[model samples]
Target: MKAVIQRTANANVTVDNQKVGEIEEGLVVLLGVTHEDGLEDAEYLAKKITNLRIFEDDSGKMNRSLKDVDGSLLSISQFTLYGDTRKGRRPNFMQAAGPEAAEELYEQFNDFVRKENVPVETGKFGAMMDVQLTNNGPVTLILESRE
Candidate 1:
């Protein structure tokens, strides 16, 4: 499992010109699942994302976690995160999990996040969705479960 976490002032996902999910003052997560990912991977990433201290505190220090700020999460499944471009001009997606398995894990990840008590919004899995966000502080971070 892997995730690209971005702090955002607001975010939304649209599919076929219809908005499906949206959030304000939160994090937008582009999540990916690989063949080896399981519940443990989901658990690890969820914990890390929720506790990550990217929000500024009283003294204007970036020391508050999402939980501290009562932020939300917009999670989107992105198998392309596993694309390998090391060879040739085309990228290979052999490391990405098959859709059936990937979607299952994706839901599990969302469930885990909700269990952590933060509001969660999600994009439709396997859908071509448009994500819009006002990235707060332009703060972006990549998190990987395997390493």
Candidate 2:
């Protein structure tokens, strides 16, 4: 499992002009599942993301965890993260998990995050979603369960 985490002041996802999910003062998690991902990977990533000290402290240091700041999360399923474009103009998605498997793990990841008591909003899986966010600090990071 992999994630592109971005700190945001506000975010929302729309499907066909309808808002599906939204959040404020949180992280936008673009989550991807690979063929090798499992429940353990999802669990590990959820725990780590919730506890990462990426938020600023009173002194302006990035020292507060998402839980510490009472923040929320916008989780989006993103199979494209695994697109392999090494040898072709068109990318290959061989590394991405099958739809059924990916959706299961994606839900597991969200459930795990919610278990940590942090609010989780999500876009519809496998749908074409339009996501908008005001990226606070423009802070972005990539995290992988296996890494």
Candidate 3:
């Protein structure tokens, strides 16, 4: 599993001109699932993301966790994160999990975050989504379960 986590002032996802999910003062998670991913991978990422101290604290240090800042989560399924572009001009998605399994894991990931007491919103699974966000501090991080 991989997560491209971005701190955001606000974020939303739209599908077919209809808003699917939205959040404010939270993180926008572009989540990816590989063939090897399972519940354990989702569990690890959820814990890590919610506890990550990316928010600023007194004296301007990034020391506050999502919980500390009372933030929410906008999770979006993004199989393209596994795109391997090292070879040719085209990116290969062989490492990404199949759609059915990926969607299951995606839901499990959101359930884990919600269990952590962070308000969780999500984009439509397997849909072409238009995501918009005001990235807070421009803070972005990529997290992977394997390494």
Candidate 4:
């Protein structure tokens, strides 16, 4: 499991010219699942993301977690996070989970976040999505469960 977490003033996903999911003053989470990912990974990542203290506090210090700020989450499935580009000119996606497994884990991850009582929105899995966001502070971080 992996995720690219970005603090955003607002974010939304569109599919076939239709908006699917949207959020404001939250995190745009590009989530990825690999073959080895399981419930534990989903649980851990969800907890970490919700509690991540990237939002600034009143003193202008980056010390407020998403929960602290009552922020939302826009989760998008992105298997390409596992793309291995070390060889040749093309990237290999052999490490990414198959569709069935990936979708299941993706839903699980979203469910985990929702269980935390945080507003959670999501993009359609396996769909070609156009995501738009006003990245707050342009703050981005990559999180991996395995390491």
Per-residue lDDT for 28-137 in model 3, tens only? 99999999999999999999999999999997999999999999999999999999999999999999999999999999999999999999999999899999999999
Model 4 spans > 4 angstroms off = none
* Each prediction's whole-model lDDT (CA): 0.96, 0.98, 0.96, 0.96
lDDT of 4 by residue, 1-147 (tens): 999999999999999999999999999999999999999999899999999999999999999999999999999999999999999999999999999999999999999999988899999999999999999998999999888
Give the Cα error of residue 96 in candidate 4, in Å: 0.3
Candidate 1 positional error at 133, Å: 0.3
In the order shown, the candidates' Cα RMSDs to the true structure are 0.6, 0.5, 0.7, 0.5
TM-score of candidate 2 to 2 decimals: 0.99
Alpha-carbon deviation at 28 in model 3, angstroms = 0.3
Instruction: Estimate, for each residue in 54-137, the C-alpha lDDT of model 1 and write its tens digit.
Output: 999999899999999999999999999999999999999999999999999999999989999999999999999999999999
Give the local distance difference test score of model 3: 0.96
Clashes of each: 0, 0, 0, 0
Q: How high a TM-score does candidate 3 get?
A: 0.98
Best by lDDT: 2
Clashing residue pairs, candidate 4?
Answer: none
Least lDDT summed over 10 consecutive residues: which range in candidate 3?
A: 58-67
Model 1 residue 14 CA deviation (Å) reads 0.2
**Candidate 4, run of 10 with poorest lDDT:** 114-123
